[model samples]
Target: MANKLSQLDQVFAALADPTRRAIVMRLCAGEASVGELADPFAMALPSFMKHIHVLETSGLVQSEKSGRVRTCRLSPDALLGAEDWFQQQRAIWEARLDRFEAYVMKLKKEKEQAAAKRPSRTARKKGS
Candidate 1:
């Protein structure tokens, strides 16, 4: 559906940035405050916040603020659409490759059969 594809597009787009991807990776272990997440990067808080914003917009991350601290966590559901798309593509390619392999094997067998039916050069020379 269009909605699914749109979500997939957003997820992929968000993940396209290394910073955003790293943020997601860090969240995988557990949720962390915005300051903790930004510690590993060399950029300023505002710059890092932009990456967080993109992830939040893409639905790949969820953040909540309590007091002065903002904590972010990964939203696993956002990735499901992308995962399903990849699985579908893998299945289709696997099927096509299997068919191609079968066709190649059939051709090889037919070639061998034709070769077996032909007379050898040695046989022709002996006949002559």
Candidate 2:
């Protein structure tokens, strides 16, 4: 779990930059060449390439160069660690919620049972 958390941290930190997020979003649709990825950012090719480097280092993206062009693609495996971390968090939260719900239901049932045990005014009058 600790390792998973660390990996999640790396993944999210890498994505914290707008350029990196944009790159990821672009890759979500399909793989693209570096030039194509850089086209919309209005940044120099070198600067944009740095963003790709960060993404690749964080394991969120993969790149391959063929001839003069470099193409990048999203790596689905990179998300697995983050997803595991989230699932652990969710499981803990759900367990707590479930316990709370059970406690509330138990209290409600106890209250109803107590109310049933109380003598009615008619019963009190008859006893008197």
Candidate 3:
């Protein structure tokens, strides 16, 4: 669906940045105030807030403001859509590879059989 793809696009785009990815990783352990999350990064708070905005837009994170502090948490099912897509792709590729392997084995067996039916060089030389 268009909506699903849009969400996927947003999620991937947000995660494409290492800073945003780090914020997401930190949130995985537990929710934290924006200040706490920004503490580990060298960027300015405003710059870090930009990354937070992307994460929120992607629906991978949710933030709540309590007094002057903003806290962020990983939204439930943050990566579920991406994970499902990867699993589907893996299954498709694995099936294709298995079929290719079977085709290759079949060709090898046929080649061996054909070689077996041919005369050896020494036998041909002796006949000539």
Best by TM-score: 1
Candidate 3 residue 26 C-alpha distance from true site, Å:
0.9
Candidate 3 Cα misplacement greater than 4 A, ranges: 125-128
Instruction: List the candidates ranked by TM-score, beginning with the highest.
Output: 1, 3, 2
Q: What C-alpha lDDT does candidate 3 achieve relative to the native structure?
A: 0.93
Residue by residue across 8-76, what tens digits does model 3's lDDT show? 899999999998888888988999999999999998998989999999999999999999999999995
Residue 29 error, candidate 3, Å: 1.2
Residue 8 CA displacement from its true place in model 3, Å: 0.7
lDDT of each: 0.96, 0.91, 0.93
RMSD of each: 0.9, 2.6, 1.3
Answer with 1 or 2, whichever has the higher lDDT.
1
Predicted candidate 1 versus true structure: per-residue lDDT over 50-88, tens digit per residue: 999999999999999999999999999999898899999
Which wins on TM-score, candidate 2 or candidate 3? 3
